[model samples]
Each structure stands twice: as C-alpha cells, then as structure tokens.
Target: MIITTAGRSPSKLVMKAKKLSTSYGLSYKERGGVSIESLKEQYQDDIVVVGKERLYIAPLYDESNLFFHPNLAMIRAKRMFKGDEDPLISTAKLTEGMSFLDCTLGLASDSIITSIAVGSSGSVMGVEGNPLLYLLAKEGLSSFSSGNHLFDQAMRRIEVFHSDHLSLLQQTKSDSFDVVYFDPMFHSTIDSSSGMNSIRGQAVKSELTKEVIKEAMRVARERVVLKDHWKSDRFAQFGFTQHKRKTSLFHYGTIELN
Candidate 1:
C-alpha cells in the first residue's frame, strides 16, 4: 500500500510519511491534485491515505469513507473501569496484574478493553494476520485521541504485532499468559453491523478450528476465550464450554485451565 498525505499536503506530513514508508516498507507518494478517484485510476488499485490523524478511504463495503475509531470499545472500557462488568473482561476473567493475548486483533476493540481490564501492571499483546489492518490498528492505538486520557492510555499500552496467531501460539511457552483470546469475524453478520465493514477487507477470514483452541489452551495459564456468534457450532465442535448471556447476539466459549 502507498502512503500519501491529504490535499497534496504539508512538509511535516510528507516527512512523517517518509518515515513511515521507510519503517513499514510501503511506498510514499505525493497526492498531486488531491483526487482519490484520480489516484485510484492512476495506481489501478485500492488506495488509502495517512490523513492528518487517521487512515481513511472509501469503504470497500459501503459508500462512506472508513476511518479508525475506538468507538464503543472506549465506552465499554470506561464503564468497566467505573465498576460495570464487560463481556470481554468476564470471558477472559481478567484482573489486575495479568497478561492477555488477543489472537485476532481486527479493529482491536476487544484488545483495548482487555488492556483496560488488566490495568497498568498488566500487559496485553495483540496479533493480527493482516498487515494493513495491523498498521491501521497499531497506529490508531498509539495516536488516536478519544478526549479521554485513561482510554487513550489503555490504547497505548496494547502491543500489536503483524503476524499469524497460530505461529505466535506455537512459539509461546505454556502458561505464559493469564488468558488467550479470539474474536474472529463471523462468517457473516447482520446488515446493521456497518461499523466492521471497513475491516472486512483486511481481516483474516480464518476458521477457529479445534487446533486453534489447543494452542490457546497450551499458552494460557488460566483461560482461553472465544467470542463468536451465538449460533456458531464452534464451541461444541472444539469442546469449549459455552456461556451465554440473555439477549446477547454473541456468546463466550471458554476453556479454563488448572
């Protein structure tokens, strides 16, 4: 993917893009004439830009431009911090001073909440199989501001990697983390789930096979959690004991270790 600034823009942004291009091994281009339509015609492929504060482009799935936003993740984290329970916290059974791994980082909403639940002394590692999604989420987690310092702090603490979770799990030592989690994108979702549409293009469309659970169990000291559609058969198929909440579209399947 090529990185470009907004509106054929600033030297500061150009310098920043140059730095990112070098670090990320992406080509940097000048947005001459500031036309995405022209640029798409010029490059003959999908195009996204490193806009002033976020990455944005016309959504592959929708008419609007899609940009990164912590969205409800931040809200839920704030509520959890103020004493309400969160499904992610509940499924992972997180507590202070724990370590957690998020195997499917996606938009990183769950990882952000996991970070908040684990607190300052704890650590959260997020793995993403998609490089573009990784770059977008990693940059968002580091630089996006929500007008809330604590939420932003939690975001900053999350360490995201661009790698397949399976490989990472294989290399991980048993009992290395308090929890290992997955929230793989469902095969399909209801139409109103427009928020995730942008991510669908770059997400790893992998099935959570029994082998995934086995590796997660080995690496986790306490639990391995999978959040999937309530109707999904993965829980029964993979032997994850299921827990469902009233009126929730998703259910948490968990395996607790000794």
Candidate 2:
C-alpha cells in the first residue's frame, strides 16, 4: 500500500507518512484529492494519512469509515465499573490485575475495554491476523487519545501483535494469562455489527477449531471466552457456558479453567 497525505497536508505530516511507509516497506507518494486510479498506479492500494494518528480507508462506503480509537471500548468499561454490566467482563469474569490475551482483535474494541477493566496493574495482549488491521489498531492504540485518562491509559496498555491466534496460543506457556478471548468473524453478517463491513474485507475469515480451543484452555488461567452471535453453534462446539442477556443479539461464552 502507498502512503499519502490529505488535501491540506503539511510538511510534518508528509514526513510522518514517508517515515511510516519506509518502516512498513510501503511506497510513498505526495498528492491530495487524487483519483482512485492514481492511488492504484503507485501504491496498488491506498492508506491515507489523516491527522497525526488517524488513517481512513478510502472510497468510504455506507458510512463505513475505518479508523481506530479506544472510545467505544473504554466507554463501555467505564460504565461497567459504574455498576453497569458488560457481556465481555461478565463472561470472562474480568477484574483488576488480571492478564488477558485477545486472540482476535478485529478493531481492538474488546481488547481496549479489557485493558481498562484490568487497570494499570494488569496486562493485555492482542493478536490480529491481518497486517492492515494490526497496523491500524496498534498505531491507534499507541498514539490516539480520547481525552480521558482511563481511555488513554487503556489504549497505551494494550500490546498488539500481527499474527494468527492458533499459532500464538500454541506458543504461549500454560496459564500465561488469566483469560484467553476470541471474537472471530461471523459466518453471516448482521446490521447490528456496526463498522464491521470495513474490516470484513481484511479480517481473518477462519472458523474456530477444537484444537484452537484446546490451546486457549492451556494458556488461560481463569477461563477462555468467545463472543459470537447468539444462534451460533460455536459455543456448544467449543464447550463454553453460553450466556445471552435479554434482548441481546450477541452471545458470550466461557470455559472456566479453575
């Protein structure tokens, strides 16, 4: 992919884009308001540099602008701390000082929330199979801020890696983390899955296997968590205790290790 700046691009931004391109082994071009064909000519694909940390997927379709931030996840986490219940925390039994490994960090929303719940003492590691998604989440988590201390700290605490979950799980030591989590793409898409369209094209489309769950069990100290559609058979297939709140479209399942 090629890196370029916006119409009002400045020297600092241009330099940043060039640096990022070099670091990622991608080509760099200087242009603004360029045609889609022009972007395809040099970079093959375009990754626009917006702001110091923001990057948008071009040709925005149906309001599916792809950018990364810890806003959604951190908001949910704050609410959860205020006596509100979140499916992720309830399912994983998350608490302060608990370590977690997010095997499928699509947009890193869940991972960010986990970091918040775990606080400063705990650690969170996220793995993304797609290089593009990893770059987006990793950079955003490190650089973006929501003007909220908890949000910023949560974002900074996440350690994201670009790799497949299965291999990472296999390489992890036994009970390395308090919780192991997965949120793979669904077999069918739903409207409630907001902002997912932008990621579907680049997300890992693999179905979770029994062996994967086995490895997760080995790596988790408290439980292995899975988030999926309520109707999905993955919970049963993977031997999780399924939980679905009233009127909730999604399901949270967990296999307790202790």
Candidate 3:
C-alpha cells in the first residue's frame, strides 16, 4: 500500500506520513492536488491517508474507508463506569487487577471495555491478525481521547499486537492471563452497517477452531470467553456454556477454568 497526505497537508502531517511509510515499508507519494480515485487507479493498490487527526485506509475496491474510532466502546465504558453491568465483563469475571487477552481484537471495542474493567493495576493485550487493523488500533488506542478520564486511561493502557490468536496463545506460557476472549466474525449474517461492512473487507475472518480453544485454555488462568451470534453452534461445539440474552442477537459464552 502507498501512503499519502490529505487534500490539505501541513508539514507535520507530511512528515508523519513519510515516517509511517518508512516504518510500514509502504511507498510515500505526494498528494499533489490529486484525487484518491486517480491515485488508487495509478498504484492499483489501497491508499493510506494520513489526515490531521487520524489515519485512513481507502481500499482499492470499496469506498468505505477504514479508520480508527472507539465506536461503541466509549458508550459502553460510560455505562459501565456508571454501574451498569456489561455482559462480556461479567462472563469473563473481570476484576480490578487482572490480566486479559483478546484473541480477535478487530476494532478493539471489546478490549477497551476489558481494560476499563481491569483498571490501572491490571493488564490488557489484544492480538489482531490483520496488519492494517493492527496499526490502526495500536495508534488509535494511544492517541484517541474520549473526554472521559476513565475511558481514555483504559484505551491508552491496552497493548495491541499483530499476530494470529492461536500463534500468540501457543507462544504464551500456561495460565499467562486471567481471561482470554474471542469474538470472531459471524459466519451467518447477523446485521448490516457501513462500519461492519468496512471491517468485513479488511479484518481477518478466521474460524474459531478446537485447536485455538485448546491453546486459549492453556493460556488463560480463570476462563475463556466467547461472544457470538445467539444461534451459532460454536458454543455447543467448544463446551462454552451459553449466556443467552433474550433481546440481543449475540450472546456471551464461557468455559471457566477454576
């Protein structure tokens, strides 16, 4: 992928884009009063736009540019801080000073919440298989501010990595984390939205298999949690006790180690 600046490029942004291009091994091209469409056609590859605030990746095929945003995490975090119980946090049985691992980080919506639940003394690590998604999440977690101190602190504390979940789990020592979580993309269509649509094209849509669970079990000390479509057979297939929500399309399931 090639990197370029936005239509209005300041020196700082231009320098930042060049630095990112060098770091990510991408080509840095001058915007030069050119349209993204023309650039994409010329390069025949996705373009990364380094805007004043955030970095955006415009896929060659899709118009929905993928960027980093906290999305629902900010809302969920506010509710959680206000004493609302979150299903995933409850399912994982998170505490103030525990370690959590998110296998499928995606946009890191879940990881951010887990970080808030775990607090400052605790730890949160997320592994994203997709490189672009990893870069976006890693940078966003550090830079984005939610205007709420608790939520902003949680977002900044997360450690994001680019790796396959199973690979990371295999490399991890036994019982390395208090909780391990997965929220793989649903095989069956659950809902439709532009955000989800943009992610679908860029995110790693890997199957959650038995082997992955085996490694997760070894890595997690307290429990392994999964969030999936309510109708998914994975809960039954992998021995995760379903925590069904009557009104929600998705459910949280868990395999408690202790």
Candidate 4:
C-alpha cells in the first residue's frame, strides 16, 4: 500500500505522511494533483491518505473511505457520566481499577469506553489484525479530541497493537488482565452504519475457536466476555453464559472465572 496526503496538501501534512510511510514501511507517493481513484488505478493498491483530521484508507474497489471515529463511545461515555450504566461495562463487571483486553479492536469504539470504565488506575489494550485499520485507530486514539477532557483521555489511554487476536492471547500470561473480551465480526449485518460498513471490508473476519476461548480464559483473571449477535450460537459453543438484552440486536456473554 502507498501513503499520500489529501488534495492540496500542506507541507506539514506531507511531512507527516512521509514519516508514517517510513514508520510503517509503506511507499510514500507524492500527491501531484492525482486523485485517490487515479492513485489506486495506477498503484493497484490501497491508498492511505493523511488528512488534516484523520487517516483515510481508500480501497481499490470500495468507494467509502475507512477512517477512525469514536462512533458510539462518545455517547456511551456521556451516559456513563450521567450515572447511566453501559451494557458492556455491566456485562464485563468492570470497575475503576480493572484491566481489559479487547481482542478485536474495530475502530476501537468499545476500547475507548472500556478505557473510561477502567479510568486512570486501569489498563486497556486492543489488537487489530488489519494494518491500515490499526494505523487509523492508533492515530485517532492518540490524537482525536472530543473537547471533553475525560472522553479525550479515555481515547488516548488505550494501548493498540497490530496483530492477530489469537497470537496476542497466546503470548499473554495467565491471569494477565481482569477481563478478556472479543467482539468478532457479526455473522449478519446488525447495524449498517457507514463506519461499520467501511470497516467490514478491511477488518479481519475470523471465527472464535475453542483454542481462543481457552487462551482467553487462561489469561483473564476475572472473566472472559464475548459480544455477538443475540442469535449467535457462539455463547453456547464457547461455554459463555448469555446475558441477553431485550430489544437489543446484540448481546454480551460471559464466562466468569472467579
């Protein structure tokens, strides 16, 4: 894949793009008044455009640009501050000083919320298999500001990695985190949000296996959680106790270790 700056790019943004290309070992292409479409056709590869606000990945086929956005995390955070409980927090039994491992870090919306629930005393790490998606989430989590100090801090606090979840889980020590969580790609489209659609094409699509659950169980001190469609059989297949939420398209399942 090649990295380039947005149209009419400033020198600073160009420098940033070049730096990212070196850091990630991607080719740096001078914009030269070429459109993303032309760039894709010429290079026959995915293009990462470093914009002023976010890094957009323009696929060779898909018209939608995949970039990082807080998505629903910002809303959930506001509700949490208003004394409303977040479903994931409730399902994970998260507290202020807990640590969370997010195996599937799509755009990191859940990770941001998990970070908030864990607070400064807590730890949150997320892993994404897609390199471009990882870069997008990593950059956004580090620099994206919501103008709310607490929310911004939550986004920034997350530790992100570009690796397969199972590999990371295998490397983790037993009881390493309080909660180990997985939110794999849904079997069916639950929400067709533009952001989700953008990620769906590039995000890793892997089924959770018994080995993964075993590794997660071994690594988690408190519990192992799975977030999937309400109708998914994974809860039963993975020995997770389904925590069904009425009127919700998805539900959380947990295997409490303690």
Candidate 5:
C-alpha cells in the first residue's frame, strides 16, 4: 500500500502518516513528523516507506538503528577501504589535533561518529545541502545531547552548516582540512527491496553528484577520499589514483584522490 503526504504541512503531514499507519494496522505516534515509536512498530518485522518527493524505507530491526543503518555508511566505507575498520568510526585515520571537512554530512551520523573519534582537540565541519535533512540532523544532535556528557562534548567538537557542498568548499581556504571526506551518493545497484530505506540517504543520493568531488578536492589539504561503487568509474574518469580499496558482504569499491 502506498501512502503519500506530498506537499502537506507538518501537522497535516503527520495526520496523513497516522492514517497510513492505522490502515496498515500498525501502532503509531506523531511528534512533529519524527515518530520513533511508530517507526519501531512499523519497521519491527517489515519495511516502511516514508516521505513523498524523496522516498526512503526503514528496517525496524537493523542494528545501527534506522538512521545509521550499516547498509548506508558501512557498505560505502568498506567498498572504499577494501577491508579496513568500521567505516562510520574508522573511515579516515583521524588524529586528535586534525580538523576535518565532511563535504556531505547526510544524516550527520558520520560527523557525530567522527567527532567522537577525533576527541576534544579535533574539530569536524559538516555541510548538508538539503534543508530538511539539515534540520532533522540538527534536531537529532540537539536531542541526542540533552543532558548527556558525550552529546555535549560531541556537539562542541562539530559544526554543521546548511549549504551546497561546492559553495561551502569554495568559501574555505585551500589546505583547510587534513582530510576532506566525500561520500557523494553514486547510483546504487543494490535492490531497495532487500535493504533498509533511509530517508536522508534517498534525499542525499538524489541531490549529490560528481561535481561535488571536484570541489572537495580543491579544498582538501592532504587528501580527498571519494567513496564509489565497485563498478562505478566516477573515480577513474575524474583522474583520481586509488589509495585504498575494500570489499564487504554487500558492496565493493575504492578510495582514491590526488
């Protein structure tokens, strides 16, 4: 069954969402269109489709929660690094004093994870183009830090902005970051029918493109890591040399930049 709340207000959108949930015989709650209980209920044993213009599915039982599903970053990271550590936690070899510019913040999971990895001395600057995702990410971060020490510390170490990747990168000086991380969404070959649907992922994939990589490279100080699919030629066409490659259970790819 398909339910659409396209071009609806927040309150009305929630109403439509609720109607769909009830029709599906699933328990649900509405809190400004960010429903945790409802998601947990619907995704418990099945997949759920959400949003209108940019659609996404959520798997109720995924280990990383619906937001930070392994299918998102983990696969991309593994494909980029070849067989390295956890992509969310270990995509880049972060140092305590280094500053990073995440060209594509997406859901801000990588930024939050990177902030923790970098510790107190390091800083992470993240840019997200989509207003909705940026707002959602900001809200999530704010909520995550409510009276939490780790959240407070992580929030302090990270700076998020709502802007296009290229525009933001143009504003930064050359060599600003020790590492500029680019995870621009390449067209995925994985069937959405079997994987968790991420709202932010779908929006990001639809909006991000290869030109963002060129901008990322221009501003990176030491290196630029472009995440791509194993079969994608975006890296090669862009003249990037492969620095690392990794494979995983679901996907494969390389990490390369000059």
Candidate 6:
C-alpha cells in the first residue's frame, strides 16, 4: 500500500520522517538527501522507504524469508547451487556479453547480482512497480557498490524503472533479453512461521497470472526463470517445464521456452 505523508518539500518530509521514525523505534537516516525510515510498524512486512511523496512497501510471502533474507543470499548459494558464490548471479546466467531484463525487480537483489555477472560488457534493466522499493533498492545498490567488484558494472550495466511489469514488457522489443527473470509475489491466506513474518504484512499477496507469464515468455530470447513457492501451481498452468532448486523456504523454478 502507498501512504502519502503530509509535506510539500524534501526538508518538510525529512522532518516528518524523523518524527515517524522515532515512533517506530527506528533511527532516521539520510538517503538521497531525504531523511528516511525503514518502517517495520503499521505494515508488518517489507522494507519501508518513506519519501516526501509516499511511503512504499511490498509485502513478503511467508516463505519468501527462506530464500530472500537480506543476509542469506550467500548461504542459499552454498546450499542451492552447491557452493557457488551467489545463486542470483548464476541463476541469472549473466555473462559478460548478455542482456537481462528483471521483470519483477522487487528488492533489486537479482538485478544487482546480474549486473555484476554481466560486468561492463552487458546491461541489466530492472523494472519495479513500487516506488518505495525502487528507491530503497537503488540506494542499497549504491551502498553495495562501495566494496563489491560489480561497482563499475552496476553503474554501467544496471538501469531501473518504476512501472508495472506488464507495461514494461510491452515496450521492449521481441527477443530483447537473453534472460527474462521473474520473482512474482504469491498470495497466501494462512501465514507460515518462516522468517518472512517481518515482511509478510507488506507483501503483495497476488500471484502473477498466466497472462503475465505469456508476456515474459514473448520477450525472452533464451529463458524465463519463475521463482515460486513449492505449493504454487501458476507455473504449471502457464505451460512451463520446470527445473527446481530447493532453498530453505522456497524453490527456484526455471521454465525454458520453446
């Protein structure tokens, strides 16, 4: 949900955010010249980015915590990919000369990883529907660049847009991407005890319908990787042949197009 805080200028917004942060037990930090707070209250899930315009937060599925914990990417890599340094970097197949389109660029983790994999020779375009998440991911990517090898690659290779995935896909040329990746948010009525509880309240509990998958397929030249919960049937209904990799809380399924 988008929450617009009252303020006309960045300074005013920063002031308001400072006040809000104090209420939520979080300290205020300056990001992009704006004072921001990661709101863990009001919304129980997803990282909150409070800006002058609005506070954007996406909900996390209960299972999402298993695969997407902020610090577990490397751990997941060791288990899922058999000691590969980072699964996202490999799952993306982001070689030096290939282009990638991350359709559901949620946390932008995939985009960041792919950007590094592609190096300076290729580009990674990430589209995120939520403005708050986009801003946070952008900032996070910026911070990550300080010590990461992909610092230069991310600067040169990654481009982010705030827009719906469907509309974004339509604007791309056919076969424009060597890989089109999706990590669509899935719906859940019953909450699980997995690590995702912190972000479950903010997650968008709707799966990407078959129509969306078809569009992703249409744009991808090489393959489409659809990350899903173990229980979801959306992938099967969309006619994707699955290759599964088990993680702590969810599975990574790849659907190769004909």
TM-score per prediction, in order, is 0.91, 0.87, 0.94, 0.95, 0.55, 0.61
Candidate 5 stretches with Cα past 4 Å from truth are 1-84, 87-91, 145-152, 186-211, 243-246, 249-258
The digit string of per-residue lDDT tens for model 6 on 1-258 reads 222233244677677667656644444545543222333343444444454434443333332322222233333433533535555556555577788888777666556567656767787888877544565555445434334343434643578787788888878778888888887763232234343354444444435767777788889988888766767786687765555666534455666665
- For candidate 6, the TM-score is 0.61
For candidate 5, which ten residues in a row score worst on lDDT?
62-71
lDDT, candidate 1, 1-258, per-residue tens: 667778856888878878888887877778877677666666654456766766765434444555567777867877886889997787778998999999988768888888888889999999988766787788889899898888999899999898888888988899999999888763233124453465465566666777778888999999888888899898888888889888888899988897
Identify the candidate with maximal TM-score. 4
Better of 3 and 5 by lDDT: 3
* Winning model by lDDT: 4
Poorest 10 consecutive residues of model 1 by lDDT?
A: 186-195
Error of 6 at 72 (Å): 4.1
List model 2 lDDT by residue over 1-258, tens digit each: 556776677888888888888776767777767854566554546455555547755522224445665556766867975889776886788899999999988668888888888899999999988766777887788888677777788888999888889988888899899999988853233224444455566566656999999999999999999988789899898899898777877878899888
**Residue 99 accuracy (lDDT) in model 3:** 99
RMSD of candidates 1 onward, in order? 2.4, 3.0, 2.1, 1.9, 10.2, 8.4
Q: Could you give me the TM-score of model 5 versus the true structure?
A: 0.55
lDDT score, residue 165, model 4? 89
Question: Tens digit of lDDT per residue, candidate 3, span 88-133?
Answer: 8888889999999999887788999999999999999999897777
Q: Is candidate 4 or candidate 6 better by TM-score?
A: 4
Off by over 4 Å in 6: 1-92, 143-146, 151-156, 186-206, 246-248
lDDT for model 2 comes to: 0.77
Descending-TM-score candidate ranking: 4, 3, 1, 2, 6, 5
The predicted structure with the larger lDDT, 1 or 6, is 1
CA lDDT of 140 in candidate 5? 47
